[model samples]
Target: MTVVPPLTRMPHLRHVLAPVLAALLVATVIAVGPGSSPAAAQQAGSPPVVVRGGGWGHSVGMSQYGAFAQAKAGRSHGDILRHYYQGVNVGGANVPGEVRVGLLQNQPSILVRSSSRNGSQPSAPVKVNLGNGQIDVAWCGGCAPIDWAIAFEGGRWVLKDTSGAIRGEGGGPVTV
Candidate 1:
């Protein structure tokens, strides 16, 4: 003979099951109540039992993972951008010949390199003018190139010349 403990003897179990049993009872009542549909009954409940859900994120821009998935499914670059941006033309405009490439965004200083020749580093790093986004390289033999830098300074982005003078500032963010 098996003797089962009463609900009073199982306080923890009772506590865990009470809300669940109550919900089930309420759901059943709402599901089978006279004349009214389950959906309508649920919508008209007192103190309203509601359900909510979340979505991807709070961005109005392209999702990187979504774009990657599209690419994997053989979508072209223009197709991917169009799908995300909506009704935007995917054509090229006249871009600056030598644009300031932002390599290290969060760094104080960056060491720029030259790829003109093998084992030949520029005497001074090529500093692109922040004002015009132009590189003034002195091609005279053995002349040191002017050092250019893009650095985060004083709570904003700045373009500095070789002598550490600010040429340009505050363009939101510098991108390649």
Candidate 2:
């Protein structure tokens, strides 16, 4: 007569049971359908399962190719911008000769020169001359003074301090 060993006493029984349990789990999942597991479905409703689709990148926002097609179909530049950017107004006017913009500390600034005749006559080049000492300015009447410095290096503008350490750098315009 043949004798069978109990599972606890049989060392090879674990190896055989592992594969059987795995196959049973796979079969149960296949029968239950994708994302239909009790835990997942209860945590969040079952989401749609996509099969096939074609897109170069993300689907959010306007497509550049669609904008190009609209332009080719006789839509103006402003029309294209307005369509892609909702709640936006597009308009243009002649440039002005001289315009002064108030500046703030550590903010980027821009200077624009235009030869259009829609505004005041062109004036001499604007300049900001700093002394050899460190720049000292206050934020408010009772605020403490802040020290800064400005210099031009390698065709770019640099803002530094008394220690010659660069605080900010850019080209195009000067910042206070």
What RMSD, rounded to one decimal, does every model reach? 24.6, 29.2
Candidate 2 — what's its lDDT? Answer: 0.41
TM-scores, all models, native as reference? 0.28, 0.21
Best by TM-score: 1
Candidate 1 structure quality by residue, lDDT tens digits, 70-163: 9799997668666654544555433222222222435676543332445454464344543335544333355444455667566555766667
TM-score of 1: 0.28
Report the number of the highest-lDDT candidate.
1
To one decimal, what is the Cα RMSD in angstroms of model 1 from the true structure? Answer: 24.6
- Model 2 CA lDDT for position 102: 20
lDDT of 2 at 40: 38
Per-model C-alpha lDDT, please?
A: 0.46, 0.41
